[model samples]
Target: MKKLTSIIVLSMAVAATETVNAQTVQKRYEENPFTLVYDGAITRNEKGKVNIHPITYQLNGITIAANIYTPANYEVSKKYPAVVVAHPNGGVKEQTAGLYAQKLAEAGYITIAADAAYQGASSGEPRHTDKPANRVEDIHGMADFIAQYKGVDANRLGVLGICGGGGYTLKAAQSDKRFKAVATLSMFNSGEVRRNGFQNSQLDTVQERLKQASDARSQEAAGGKIRYAGVASITDEEIARTPTDLYREGFVYYYRTYAHPNSSFLYPMSSLLDLMTWDATTNIDLINQPLLMMAGSKADTKYMTDEAFNKAKNAKNKELFLIEGATHIQTYWKPEYVSQAVNKLVSFYQNNL
Candidate 1:
């Protein structure tokens, strides 16, 4: 593992080659307003390099799909470093998770970005219902699968999460020391944020939250679908007034631009019930590995990331990186911004893992 100090900042140049991807992603969203579809697999064959192969594993006794990307130079004779990257809420591995995994894999790290249980390609009876015990288990489960891979070092395993996955990764790291290092990009403590917004300032009372979730459950039981109140697509009127609103930023990526229409996750409104029971900050004292938290300066959840970093204890190595001119959703699939975030991740893992 690497030390917490002596950092390096990598520069990303906008090359003409990147334009094709930009245009393709742009066109996909232009056609589909609700879904940000990817034209093809994010992990592809690079000829002289390796290809991203679709791999399946069982999670929760269901057949789940995962994309495993091995480095072009990977050989079965030796073990290599690996990272398990989880996607954001309402996202599939084909979107941001798969992209990060492929990029890191190309850089010589065996990367597996899997779809979480009950979402995307993973098997779950009730669609989109995420459980803390099971979801966190998903993170460690992926690590176990990677550890047994033919070329994995097993001892040098690491994990990463984006947004909601960010919070869950911490929970996974606390008990599952199998991971040598841990990092988060645009981290979101979903359990904390779902029950309360921005530092528990919005919903400070457990009774208030219980009322809402319970009411939603009752409505669902009455044969009505539980609806979501959070932001999905923000209008211009709302955006101009509250430009930094989480929903507004989410609209820019998940709906308008940089949105992958072909992604496979369904945003289940009822999952809030499960989320109401989840809280990653409750047991912050348990994490004992290296922790790297990355967030964008323009992101609203700066507090979410900060709050998590502050609560962490006994972590052998820790760091907090803030990227300029980016918001919460902007880091999801935005190439320019994600490049910076992923590079920090690569360097962090390189120096430590």
Candidate 2:
């Protein structure tokens, strides 16, 4: 009876702790008007310090919402290197992409992080459409806009994509010679995962999934109700029960700690029709520019990066940097890991850009 009582008390304590943590996170989210959830986020733009400019531009007839970060004491008369940052699938510019853009600005570079077409604050129909071609085009659109910004040195442009954005960046850099340097963090191949499942766990269900995606597309064509896939919301217990560190931590990060109203995991089910047939590594050797790919040393998604990195045979000055002692999601916000990544990125861009 004593042992049973102790166990029950422990369970209650754990539950109470989780409740407190969730409430704290909720309060933080509500307090930030910009919906910026990262640590040390800029509250207001000031001169002689890093400043953020929220701007929108028309991209292929869709309005693209982006945040451009200008360095401390920025002068439009003096040209500065610029980077176009691509966010992960289901991510908005206000999340990790914005954090990196802000950090890069502090390092004296002009950086722009934009919402993909049909996602975030950007304009599009059947929202959260996750297609490879559309994602790749979004990166191109960012480069097109930032290259024309007043203080940007268009010739010294670079691109950095995170997670699924990394996969699309690989695709974008293949044909867009405007990006002088290309880098990726925690690279995730959306095509491979959508078809094969994470870590290829659903190999046997490929055909079945493809058929379902095809049907979804057919329904859309017929003007039927649009369907969405992926997690809309999750419980703490569900998050704790998730087996993979990438997913379990991802749930807590996206739905709890770093939750934002505009950020979501849902994507149009019809999007799988385009995503399933695509691959980020196809013709990767076409990327002849300088390349840097970083991933957590212990990330389950590291294999995707490894496969893509190795296939970029023609890339100049190629490197694969592993952030020590980090899982895939940890690199997004953990201070130690984020610091390491930012430093490496600054060095890489300085040398190549």
lDDT per residue for candidate 2 within 1-353, as digits (tens), equals 99999979878876886788778777876776666778888888887999999999998899999999999999999999999999988888888998999999999999999999999999999899889999999999999999999899999999999999999999999999999999999999999999899999999998998888888888899999888889997766678799999899888888777767778999988888888899999999999999999999999999999999999999999999999999999999999999999999999999998
**lDDT for each residue of candidate 1 in 106-145, tens digit (9 for 90 to 100):** 6789988887787776777566666677679889889878
Q: How big is the positional error of residue 113 in model 2, measured in Å on the Cα after superposition?
A: 0.5
TM-score for candidate 2, residues paired by index: 0.94
Give the Å error, residue 94, model 2.
Answer: 1.1
Clashes of each: 10, 0
Best by lDDT: 2
Which stretches of candidate 2 lie above 4 Å from their native place? Answer: 1-26
Q: Model 1 misses residue 95 by how many Å? A: 1.5
Clashing pairs in 1: 1-352, 2-351, 2-352, 35-261, 36-259, 36-260, 36-261, 37-260, 37-261, 37-262
Tell me the RMSD of model 2 versus the true structure: 2.5
State the C-alpha lDDT per candidate.
Answer: 0.74, 0.92
